[model samples]
Target chain A: MWVALSYACWGISIVLALWMLYDWFKIDTTYSEEMLTSSREGELEAVSEKHRI
Target chain B: MTIAAEPAVQVQGDRVSLLRVLGPAHVWALGVGIVLVGEFTGWNFAADKGGALAALIVCWIVGLLYTSVAMIDSEVTSTVAAAGGQYAQAKHIVGPLMAFNVALFLVFAYTMLEVSDAILLGDTIVAKAGVEGLNHNSFIAATIVVLAWLNYRGVLMTLNVNFVITAIAYVSIVILFLSVSPWTQGAVLKLNELVTPGNALPYGWIGVIAAFQFGIWYYLGIEGTTQAAEEVRSPARSLPYGTMAGMITLLIAAAMTWYVCASLMPWEYLGITYYPLWDAGKLTGSALLENLLFIATLLAALASANGCINDAARAWFSLGRDRYLPTWFSAVHPKYRTPYRSILFLLPIALAFAFIADLNQAITFSILSGVLQYTFMSINIIMFRKKWPLGSIRRGYTHPFHPLPAIVLFCLCVVTFFAIFLGFGSQLIAMVAFYFLISLWFHFYRYKFVRRGAQFTMPWPKPQGY
Candidate 1:
């Protein structure tokens, strides 16, 4: 039973890996300068107010 | 045919310029790394302290927690995509002091791992050549030069190495599994569940805790991918997805290796040998299979060495850029665009440590810092949403359950970190803690590097001067 379950997990992981691999190739490769100009950019907050210079 | 990035200052405002050619797949490959050597060899050590089942249970827990952390980390990648990567995330959420700590940990861990990889390569080469008294240092130096050259060439070439190394590694692992079908008719495939007097669980529960220290090694370097987040093409999309995908691949590799090794050999026996998979192939399979695994071990180490160099430079680049270190540390080669100087800076340190430091001690120190880095990532998540809020930070894929993943991962990481340090004898932990305090003192008091805003890239719509 334990062996079966371990195999099952491995199976799921393999399938997920294949999916990731497929997506890895299909996803766009070019750097998107537009991404910088489209999202909210200026409302920046320091990570920690206590430590910020 | 080519989509050129907009002018550096126009889009990024001048303080940024890494050629972002890496896509999601490249990022994913980098994330999975060459192989989880721990899962392949070192994890059995954990089984000595924790029963086989106990070791397996601890691995499951650690793996699942890391998956959660990755999910949360993806959110970080989406929000603040910078060359600084996780250190930047920590900077944005925790402050430069904590970022400084995390950065040092990453730098130390990567350099230390590279040392081990180089020594392991030397050992493997001597064995393969069947040559006595091979000058190991020369071979190690040659390997470092090759690794450094690949990285110095730029991200695309370094990435190209990742593609070839990772493919060979995966193929080798497949070959190993096929050599002996532990899931089926292999003679050693039985459960060996006789829990009578001297069963697999001899040390009982105490053993499980011991086993986990090694078990965590399986997924140790996956987070190094986060270092590459800055160089990805569409980091917002690729970083989150790539990281999670990498984690899943490692999980599968870990499970397959654990099942095969545990089923085929006595857990105690597996712990003693350095090359568990290579040893497995020797005992049960043909000579050809044993040779393949021997080659696999070297190839995997090569992949890891290459990965460490690239990521460590980026981490160093981040520190240099932020003025935490000397400015020259982050200086880019005019032609390569890669941080050539930073890579060089790490090489000497890596060489020194590789020759002098014990391999086990190197791995242990690397793990200690790795766990702390993970804990810092979780803390970044907990503070990130609050620092930027919903409207301020763009949502690529928000991790479900808000802070649950962060909280859970933080607990697991800290406990593991403490346990491993304690195992090294409390004095080592004390020294590390003391170093931590000294760094904190330096950062809060004597450290004088002020932030000179660079053309930092944030995942927001409108470009802002960083």
Candidate 2:
């Protein structure tokens, strides 16, 4: 019975992991554009400040 | 409002290099946990019981050859730094048809492998728990769904989990080896058995070759570290280093595990059962040890399965991005930054195979498809060297011998392909037929349907300064 439960748990864990991965990917891809643009702006600002020095 | 000229908007590429995305330890963990266990268990089984010393020698040679080819692959990636890795290289140096074929084979192979790993995990759990009449199919199906869910979350989460799981797996192997050590009654042959011939090649040279071919399946995802190159920090250096480091770590772990297994049990006893490692653990005379080993195997399989899903989803994303398949596959979730569509697309395929196919059939199909893809990638290295010559300075890692190992791997791949057909029977034929039909469908879809009377040309980038 323990073995059976282990098998079930193992199966369930994988399904849970997959669901989690999906949600993670969804979040990453959705915000990527905004994140990329903001990061670029920050870099440009840093570059301009360095040149002013 | 004055109609002033709009401020120039500078757009920077959001793409990440492969090295920046991967830490050395993360790469090491993946190499040890994900690649090693997946390749080693079955490899040692074939080497010790099925092919004997000849098989072991052949595999070592193959391993070295594979390592060399991987080095060449690093050079290719460094030069192009393209998203698709092998697929991109094949298309650029060869043609779209070849790239499409390689991509399709890779996706199918990895998908089958993920299901197979899940099934093996289920089996290990069942064995340890001493469970009878377990529905293997349902268990596998459930596991596939779980794996899909994990990957759907994102790469970072998967990697983080993989790191923990890999640590557990290493500990398990160590405990298993130590636990089983007391069982040796001076009966375990050491150096002598390395060369001693027995039923190891039960079916003679043909069988030995076939076993070694199947054994190569264990090493299937070693190149996967390269897949994450876009995320790594300094891909030119790190990609090659990470890849080689991962391979070396896996080789050591595998050799250690195999040596321990060989030292603990008689070859004859090892050959009698499929779950030999678990059996060895049971000989420790401690129920707790048995349970621990079982849990460890499950964790190893889980980590491997998770890694496989991540690799497969990314490959699918690359395929879609390159317009090789439907554009929807390239769809990243607006919020998640993940290839949401591709992950969703792969779940059903993996789950269907897990539930529908028998375990052995699924494993055989996965191995055969993997061998086919590896063959192409190995050959592509040699082809690239000749077609696109490097200048005086070697930028990235170069293969030690210019074309020798690559040539040998190519030959080995061909031998393995034929051997798989002979050993695997009808499934081999079905897989080949499936791949060819998929290729034809893609070709037609691209030329006749999607392009619709437009001329089909190579998807080559315009030369700089043109």
Candidate 3:
């Protein structure tokens, strides 16, 4: 029974991690349209802060 | 009156801001980076309390609790993006005094964690390389200088390095797992036998309670991810997703790391070992694997140190910039937009403490402060929701079950905090005394100098129905 519980814990944790991995990879396309529009503002800010030290 | 002509009136160009250099990947790395060291070390201490099986159970329970907290914190971060994080959450919901207490809890806790991480790195290297008479104090101080310089360069550079170091650390875990995955129930010591009640959970049910202090290691710094809310792009979405990834990754890593290591030996043996992974690698009977595991453990500690230093400095920056603390902490590198002055100010102090502090005390006090900070943040969530009701506020995300999760977590933290304190009588008393001292200190600072009508209302997300 204890062994079963141990494996069950591991199983649940692995599933959660796999789900998060899937979510992490989807970042680029999830908000592609918004990303495109915002890129212009982001570019100017990036340039301004580029050599910040 | 022309807005530009009025010195008090600020324009868009005049508002100083942190650069949005972090994307989803950077946020994910930083979230995991700050806490990933849990996989390498610290988990074994729980074994001392409740044997291996009890410790494993403790890790699982703590992992779930922290994951829940991280999810709730995600919504708060997305709605009101700021460097102040939980501190800012309290300010909007409770008031400045509560906000002050929360900020001090976070700042001091992370600073302590940073110091401890550096010390751990120095000690781990000394053990790994077999260097006698090594000046770890000098080693830690030098390492902090390099880390601070990296941070001063820019957030982008600091996070990029974090991503690389974090990735290597994770890969190391994967390697260790794969190397031992094929072992058949441990030729050295079968896991099932080791977990039998008298063996794995020697102290009985009460020992499980004692184990929670160490259980905190698995997910302690995962919440530090929210400290990066101001730096991430599309914070509403990115912050939540990044933290979810980080929590899930840590949960899995903790379980696997515990399982494989415990499979090799009894908690009696593994629990006392200074480097569990390095020793666990020997059960595979491969020298190459052992060395690889040891190196990975060191890298993991370094990554955590990097993240903790960055998180602590940012917290100081937010406080200093808001005039809650000294304005000197608010000074940013003119070009990099990073809080160089704040990082430098705390670096020496952290280094000094790292040399004298004990490992157990570092872990306990960190969790103690966390207990206070999270309690305030969770209650703040309930209060904020009450003030703005569902559909009344323009929030980035809505948590299901309203404030049930917050209330549940707050109660759980309170109960668990006191329960864990049962084991650390002296430390608990000392922490409470220090807590009072700081409260008095903050009161003096505020009462003496903070003038009337000088403070402005926070720009929290406006309530739609209001």
Which structure among the candidates has the greatest DockQ? 2
lDDT measured at residue B293 in model 1 versus the true structure, 0 to 100: 78
Displacement of the residue B82 alpha carbon in candidate 3, Å: 0.4
Put the candidates in DockQ order, highest first.
2, 1, 3
DockQ score for candidate 1: 0.02
What's the number of clashes in each of the models? 13, 47, 3
Model 3 bad stretches (over 4 Å): A1-53, B1-16, B182-189, B447-466
lDDT per residue as tens, model 1, B78-157: 76777656787777666667777878888877887787777777666665666545546655765666677678667776
Candidate 3 residue B394 Cα shift, in angstroms, is 2.0
Q: Chain B alone, TM-score of each model?
A: 0.90, 0.84, 0.92
DockQ of 3: 0.02
User: What is every candidate's C-alpha DockQ against the true complex, given to 2 decimals?
Assistant: 0.02, 0.15, 0.02
Candidate 3 lDDT over B183-262, as tens digits, reads 66655446787677568678887787788777887777888887787777667888888888888888888877888878
Worst 10 residues of 2 chain B by lDDT: B1-10
For model 3 chain B, give the 10-residue run with minimal summed lDDT. Answer: B1-10
The native-contact fraction of candidate 1 is: 0.00
- When 2 and 3 are scored with DockQ, the better candidate is 2
Cα displacement (angstroms), candidate 3, residue B448, comes to 5.4
